[model samples]
Target: MPTKRDLLDLQFMDARCKLIDLAAFLDRIERHEGEPDFRLAAFREALPILLSEKPNRARAVLEALSDQTPEPIEAATIQGAFGAPQV
Candidate 1:
């Protein structure tokens, strides 16, 4: 059960980090709080799969988006994405 990080031969780092990236994006945008409801919904749905053991990250993301529902998110642990400074 290798984590995505172990697959160094493959080049899809951004894809691997979609859930995390989305989460941070959601957190950053919460202050404005005017994002489309579906974006929030997608984030809510995707969170569970993010924690699961899945060989295929794309599949988890797809499943999460396939049936997203509205849910409120409490504060997320925000961090700099991909080690780049926040704007």
Candidate 2:
């Protein structure tokens, strides 16, 4: 059985993947002119999903951002600000 920590980690990873997909979609929008309006609207709809109330999702995004070779310290700072797990 997966421990609570493991479950949390997995949830975090899933959320991060969703965020990465959102970023790629945004990049596509930025790179292309005459993109459909619906595309932009869809991207906007996904924004809240990527930044949902779930802490694991946020943590996952932060983890992936921190893993970049350049290491975005801002992500780490945000994660740290959330503090440790509650009892």
Tell me, by TM-score, which candidate is best: 1
lDDT of each: 0.59, 0.56
Deviating ranges (above 4 Å) for candidate 2: 1-4, 49-87
Q: Candidate 1 lDDT, tens digit per residue, 17-82? A: 874787688678776845455545665666777677868876777755553335534754664222
Error of 1 at 82 (Å): 26
Location of the lowest summed lDDT over 10 successive residues in candidate 2: 78-87
Candidates in order, TM-scores: namely 0.43, 0.41
**What lDDT, from 0 to 1, does candidate 1 have?**
0.59
Judged by lDDT against the true structure, how good is candidate 2? 0.56
Candidate 2 lDDT by residue in tens digits, 1-87: 999899888798896897698689778878887845543453354456564777676555444433234534454435343222211
RMSD of 2: 14.2
CA shift at 66, candidate 2, in angstroms?
A: 34
